[model samples]
Target chain A: MSYSSQAIAKPYFTVAITLFAVQVLFGLIIGMQYVAINIEGIMFDTARLIHTNLLIIWLLFGFMGASYYIVPEEAEQELYNPKLAIQSLWLFLALTIITVLGYLLLPYATFAKITGNQFFPTMGREYLEQPTIIKLGIFAVLCAFTYNISMTILHGRKTIINLLLLTGIAGSTIVFIFAFYNSSNLVVAKYYRWWLIHFWFEGTWELIMEAILAYIIFKVTGNREIVEKWLYIIVAVTLTTVILGIGHHYYWIGVPEYWQWIGTLFSVFELLPFFFMLLFVFNVVNCTKCHSSNKALKLWALSTPIMAFLGAGVLGFLHTLAPINYYSHGTQITSAHGHLAFYSTYVMIVLAIISYTMPILQNNINNRIVQKLEILAFWLMTVSMSFMVLFIAVAGIMQVYIQRATDLALPFIEIQNSMMILYWLRGAGGLVFFIGVIIYIIGFFYNRHLAVD
Target chain B: MKILTKPKYIYYSSLIIFICLLLGLTIHTIIVLPERDHRDNLTPQIIQGKMVWEENNCIGCHTLLGEGAYFAPELGNIYKRRGGSHGGAYFIKAWLKAMPTNIPGRRQMPQFNLTDEELHALIAFLKWTSEINTSSWPPSEKG
Candidate 1:
C-alpha cells in the first residue's frame, strides 16, 4: 500500500469477503428450502433474514474498504487520523457481529424485546432489521467514516472522483436515518422507506460505484480526462433518471396515481447510465489499448458494467412499468432481478477492487495460482448466476401466467409447488455458486506474500 | 462530450438542480400521503397489530406490500381475501394457532404462541393493510 492508512482496508476486506461467504452459504440453504429441503430452526424466513442482512453489511464494508484505499491515493495524502479510523472500524465490526449473533441465537420476537425495540420500534423492517441499539452504533460509525473521508479530501487534492464519492457517502448516511422514523401506518412506513431504499440503491450507491469504476478504468487505461468525462455523463444520467424513477416503486405502494406516469416515464431512461457505463469502460480500455497481464483485473473490470447492465438495466426495465410489475412485483421475477442486480452491481465491483488492490498491497503481481482461481471463480459465478436468474425468470413468467394472468388462478401454494423443477435448477446453481465462493476464498490465502486476510 | 470534459461545475450544478426538483416533488408526496394511505383509519388496535407483525418479523416470510420475503403469500390482502370474503378473522386465528403442520418435506412456520389479544390485533392490522390504496396490485387474488 502507498499510504499506511490504506493498509487498514485489509481488515475491512476480510470482513467483507468472510461475510460474503456466509451470505452465500445462507443463500444456499434458502435455495434448498425452496426445493423441499427443510431447515428446521433457521427455516426459510430466518435464513432469508440472515442472508439479506449479510449482503447489505458485506457491501457496506466493501464500500468502506474501497473508500479507505481510494481516498489517500486520490488525495495524495495519508488519512486524516489513522488511529481514529482504526477505532471506528473496530467498533463497527463489534456492533455488526453482535447484531448478526442476535439474529441467530435469539428468536425474532425475543431479540426485539431484549433490544428494547418497543421504545423506538425500528426492528423487523426489510434490510433495516438491525436492533435499535445497533442502528445507533451504525449511525455513529458512519459519522466517523464520513468525517474521516471528508477531512482527508479537505486536506489534499480534491478530484472529481473524491467529490462525488463524498457526496454519495454523505447522502446515504443521511438517508439511513429515515429508518429510525417509524410510523404505525403501514403506508406511511412503506412510503418513507423508499426514500432510503431507492435513493441509496439507485441514486447514491451508483455514485459510489461509478467513482470506483472510473478510478479503476483510469488506473488501467491512463486516460483521466476521458474517464472523468464519461463518469460525469454516467452520473448525470443516473441521477436524472433514478431520482424520478423512484416513482416506479411508489406506484402501487399506496402512493398517489401520478406515480404511475412519473415512475414509468423516468424509469425508461434508467437504462441510459448502465449503457453509458458499459460504453465508458470499453472505450477507455480500447483507447488506452490495455495489454495488462493482470487477466483477473481485466476480467472483473469488464464484467462489472456488462453484468450491471444486464441485471439492473435490462432486467430492471422489464418490470419497471406499472402494468408489468403489477403481475411481477411479488413474484420470482423480482427475486431474479434483485439477485443479479445486487451480485453484479455491488458484489462484482467490490471483487474488482479487491483483485486490483490486494496484489499491490501485498507487493505481488499476477501470482499464477491466484490468477487462475479468480478467473475460474469469475466464470463459475457468472455462468451459475446467469443460470440461476434464467430459471427463476422462467419460473416467474410461468407463475404470472398460471397464478395471476389465468382466468382461473391457482392458489399461491399450488403455484409454488408447480415450480419444483425450476426450484431444483436454482438450487443446483446455488450449489455451484457456493463452490465458486469457496474457490475464491481459497485463492485469497494461496498468495505467497499474503499480508491481508 | 466536449462540454462535459471542459467544466466540472456544469455537472455539479445539474446534480443540485435535479435534487432540488425531487425535493419539491417530495413535499407534494408528504402532503398527500396522510390522505392517500387513509392515515385516519389507522386505529390503536391496528397499530398494535402492526407492532406484533414487526416484532415477529412477519415480513421475513410473508410479504406485506409486494415487498419482503416471497416464501409465503402476500399477507397484506389477507383481510380481504379471507376475512371479508369467506373465512374472516376466525380463520386467521385458527391458522395462526395451527403451528408447524409437521408435514414432512414441507416448509414450516414457527409457532409464536401469540395471545388472543395479539391475534385480534394482528387481524386488525391486516384489515387496515387491505384497505390501503395500492393502486390495485397483484393482478388477482393469487397474491
Candidate 2:
C-alpha cells in the first residue's frame, strides 16, 4: 500500500496534461474558424493539423501514463525499470513535437509555394492526408510504450486488468502494423488506411475503455466481484463490436456492397456495451451511497461512462444506420460523431484519471464544496461540448437534405452561409466549455497548493 | 455445501443465433445481388471510356448512381435531364471538352488535355452511366 512521490510515472502524466491543454486550445481555434471563414486561413490549417494530431498524441500519452501508474500495482511488482519508462516518455514527447512542427511548417515550405506542380505529390496536399510520416512517428511511439508495458506485465503480476490491458496493447500493435503498408497501387493504400483509423477507434479503444470502466468501478466502490462481472460483459461486447463493427467505415469505401448491411447491423448492437457502461457507472456509483461526499469523484465516475453512451452510443447510432448514413457519411454529422465519441471515451478517460489523481495528490482537500464546484465544471464542459456536437449534427442533416437529396444546384457558399448560426452556437458552446476548463484549472492549482508534496 | 451453477446452454445458443443472423444476411446479399456484366462484355470503347473517367477522378466530383462526392451535378440522369436532340452524345462530348469555358461562376472542371481517343472513351463511359436504370432518380427532368 506504499505510494511514492518520486514515481517515474509522474512525468508521463505531466506531459499528457500539457498535450491535452494544447489540444483544447486548438479545438477552440477550430471551433472559432467554423464561425468565421475569413479569420486568417493560416489559423484554420494550423488548427486542423493540431486538433487532429494532438488527439493522437494526448490519448497515447494519457493511456501510456495510466498504464505506467496501474501496471505495477496490478503486477504486484515495481515497473521493470522506472528509468526506461522515463526515457520512453521523453522520446515520445520529442517525436510528437517534431511532427507537430513539421505539420505547421508545411504551408510555408517551398513545395507548398510551387504552383501547377503538385506539392508533396507523393503525399496529398492536405496536411491531415500526409499520413506516411505522421503514421510512422505514431507507430514508433506506440511500439515503445507497448514493448515497455508488455515487458513489465510479463515479468510482474497477472490480473483481469492486465488481460484487458494486454488486449488493448495487441490492438495498438495491429494498428501500427497497418501503418507500414504502402502499396504501389493508390486505391489499395486508401483502403488500408481506413483499417488503421477505423479499427483503432472501434477495436483497440474499446478494450482500453472497458478496462478503464472496470478500474473505476473497482476503485470507487472497493468491490472486486462486481468489477469482475462487469469486465466480462464489457469484454464480450467489445469483441462483438470490433470483429463486425468495422463495416460502418467500409460503407462509402468501394470495398464491397455487403459490408453496408453488416456494418449497420453490428454497429447497432455495438451500442450494448455503451448502454451497460452507462448503467454500470451510475448504478455502481449510486450503490456506494456516499451521499455527496466525494461528489467530484462520483461525478467524474458517473459522467465518463454516461457521456460514452449519450455521445458514442446514442448519437453514434442516430446517423450510423446505412440508409441514413448513405447521405451523411462524409458530412459534418460524421464530424459530430467523431468529436463527441472521441471526447467521451478518450478525453473522459484522461479526465477521470486526473480526477482520481487530484485527490490523491492533495489528501487534505476534504472540502465537499470545492469538489462539488469541480463537478459542476465537469458538467458545464461536458454538456456544452456534447450540445455543440448535437447542434452541428442537426446542421449536417439539414445540409444533407438541402444540398444532397434535392437538386437545387445551390452553391456551397449559400449552404455554408446558412450554417453560420449553427457554427455560432457551437462557438458559444465552446466558450462555455472553455470557461469550465478555466475554472477547473484554477481548482486544480488551488488543490495543489493545499496538497503541495 | 456450495451449489455449483449448471452451465447455461442458452447462453451458448445465443452466440449461435448471432452467427446465424450474420450468415443469413450474407446469403440474402448474395441471392439478391444483380448479375454483373463482365468487363469484356462492356465494349472496349466503353471500357476505355470508364478508364478515362477514373483517371481524371470524374466520379470524385460527379456521382453516377448516387455515388461519389456531390460537389458537382448528378451525371446519372444528365442525358435525359438535359433533354433535346442537341443533348445527345455529340453535345455531351463537346460540353465536357470545353467545360467552364462558357459558364461563369461555374466550378471549372479541370481540363485533363485528353486526346480525341480519350475524349471519345469518356463520352462512352458517360453514355454507359446514362443508360443504367435508376428508376427515376434525380427526381427531375432538368437535374
Best by TM-score: 1
Residues B1-143, candidate 1: write the lDDT tens digits: 55745456656676788778778888887798877778888788999999999999998888888898888888878878885757768888898899778777566778899999999999988887888878887678767
lDDT per residue, candidate 1, A1-453, as tens digits?
Answer: 778889877778888898999999999999999988865567677788889989988898999999999999999999998887789878988987898788888898999999999899998889988899998998998898899999999999998888889988998899998989888878778878888889888988888999988888888887788887888788778877887888888877887898888888888899899999999998789768775678999999999999999999999988888888889888889899999999889899999998888887777777888999999999999899999999999999998899889899987777788899999999999999999999998887676346443
When only chain A is evaluated, what TM-score does every model earn? 0.98, 0.90
lDDT of each: 0.87, 0.64
Q: Evaluate model 1: give its lDDT.
A: 0.87
Q: Write model 2 residue lDDT over A1-453, tens digit each, in one string.
A: 233522555566667767777777777876776665334434354556576777877787777777776777777777776776777777888877865665565442222223211312223311223344455556666776777778778997777787688778767776766655543222234445556776677767778867866776677788766676666666667666656676676564334566778889988988998988877776776777443346676667777787888788888887777777777765667678888999888888777766665566456544565576688788888899989988888887777777667767453435766777888898888888878877776666566667656
Candidate 1 segments whose C-alpha is farther than 4 A from its true place: A448-453, B1-9
Worst 10 residues of 2 chain B by lDDT: B1-10
DockQ numbers for every candidate? 0.73, 0.08
